[model samples]
Target: MPSRQWPNILITGTPGTGKTTHAAQLVEALQSSPSTSSATWEHVNVGDFVKEKGCHSGFNEEWQSWDVDEDKLLDELELVQQAGAKVIDWHTCDLFPERWIDLVLVLRCDHSQLWARLEKRGYQLNKIQENNEAEIMEVVLNDARESYAAEIVVEMQSEKPEDMEQNIERIVSWVQAWRADYGG
Candidate 1:
């Protein structure tokens, strides 16, 4: 893969596992950090990106969500991935090309907490149950592992606020180390 100024990290997990929360905070943290001040980091929410880039085929009534055209979405991501300073947030991970991502953090929440989060969001019963099952099965975690190098994929705990803080600290250090090893 051609080198870039910074890393492209993907924060993925089943719904209600704080993937968006982690992605947003990571960008904010990276942007403010002195070590990575030379790079501009952004939180790219895939769902919104799909709509913005016209990568969706249509809404799915059964799922009550937009049907993502994976090929179109991947095509739209080519340039953005090359830029290489984004925190991409999404539930699905394996579909992204292996080379586009440098790190994959799969946030996992306790089943109870996951349920509460989904419920608090007023998710439909079926949607909540489906996500709960997916989390229990470790679907996203497995997909991330299969999609990226073992060293690049991390399973993170997302049950408490402190976990998020710790993740940011570790990732910041990782960024600095990456800079040491790779020219920006």
Candidate 2:
């Protein structure tokens, strides 16, 4: 492996915006490259990591979700963050430190498209509506911009299959460029 650190890319967005899909594709693409063979690329799903690692303090009755303690989660992810080359997929972005993340891809979907995707997931009507509203409002994009430098944060549309492919290609190119510039 190169002595230079690899990038820690965060794929964050409103639920059902295809963050996981992008993350998985990114990992697969990177792992297939001979240049990146020495580098370790991990797809860290924050929601599942939190649950499996017991990083949350408690569960939320209203949302029916775990109340993730930012500090605890960070503590638990310390080693992974330090290892780098991580594709961190999560709905929230601001909790992760700016220094640890090299790129933030805030995936966005059209309100109607996002609504249908969430609905297909069997999400409650209220939850679906809430996520749709968040997408319409560009909450995740704004949060990513606020949490990371503008140069490091990108807002990409993922409403269609082509959009997702384009995103994956763009990030793959980015990784190639980064390796060329920084890796041995």
Candidate 3:
């Protein structure tokens, strides 16, 4: 199959917005459905991938996260992108080039729900506040829209289990549609 026939999806949002959960569930669902084609889809956790691939330049003490070198990360992602049908899970969206992504799903959550989730994860007070503020300001959503075309960027709320299920089903349908359109 041509590379463009397989869609590359990016699931991005603030830390507690359930991006990884959704991406994993979606991959499982797609894999189980025999009708969804034999082409395998990969869930690429950008954080873990960065560490495993040594794409970061250094560590950030304040955030307790890697100081990712964007260029290096992109270089590493090139090979993964070529594999196609990747569910790229990450917190930041705009760093990736738009042409490489077919869809950008920016998961969102209620501020209170997000705060509770972050607190449950044992995030520092300042870190929680920073994430809450970013969510409230629609930082990820805005960045996704700016980085990709409006038609391809979707902002969906993920505060409940039902929402997660619905989102997964919706994305499955989208993948099927994409396959039909692109001759996957």
Candidate 4:
């Protein structure tokens, strides 16, 4: 694919990792950071997008989440990507083809923190155990590494307020560099 006017950022991780929060902040940061070029940035939360676009087959009782139809979801997002910049927030990353993404941020949190966050969210025992194990095993991180080129994938800690602020600053700088290199 030809270079886009702006980048598509995929924020992925195990469920309690603050992917949504980071994506939202990134979009806002990009918009207000006084860049040289004009841009249209957005946060695309895949779980919500799937349900809104009818790209999910049904709800998964076991996981208490939607059973997304991958093909249908991807088909819709292909059009969305054509528009401009996007910060896609999801628990899975490998499903996205590398060509469609400019950056892959795999957010991670400590297992104890993750467990507490999941519990706070009212996740059931099975769901909580599944996510906690995934975090411990670095499941999302491995998936992101295997799917995208190493240079484009960044692993970041999302455990505290300071970490989030630092992440946003770092990513914004990266975006500025990207825009400069690619004529955004």
What is the TM-score of each predicted model, taking all chains together? Answer: 0.96, 0.94, 0.96, 0.96
Expressed as tens digits, the lDDT of each residue in 1-184 for candidate 3 is 3456678999999999999999999889888877675878789999999999999888988987899988999999988898678999999998987778988999999999999999999999999999999999999998988888899999888999999999999998998888888744
lDDT tens digits by residue: candidate 2, 115-141: 888878988888898888898888989
- What lDDT does each candidate get? 0.89, 0.87, 0.90, 0.89
lDDT of 4 by residue, 95-173 (tens): 9888899989999899999999999999999999999999999999999989999999899999999999999999998
Comparing 1 and 3 by lDDT, which wins? 3
* All candidates: CA RMSD (Å): 1.1, 2.1, 1.5, 1.3
How well is each residue in 1-184 modelled by candidate 1, as lDDT tens digits?
Answer: 3388788899999998998988889888889998897788888999899889989889987777899999899888988888888899999999988888888999999998899999999888898999999999999998888778899998999888999999989988898888778844
Instruction: Name the TM-score of candidate 2.
Output: 0.94
Per-prediction backbone clash count: 0, 0, 0, 0
Between which residue pairs do clashes occur in model 2? Answer: none
Off by over 4 Å in 1: none
Off by over 4 Å in 4: none
Cα RMSD (Å) between model 3 and the true structure? Answer: 1.5
**For model 2, what is the C-alpha lDDT against the true structure?**
0.87
Scored against the true structure, residue 133 in model 3 reaches a CA lDDT of: 99
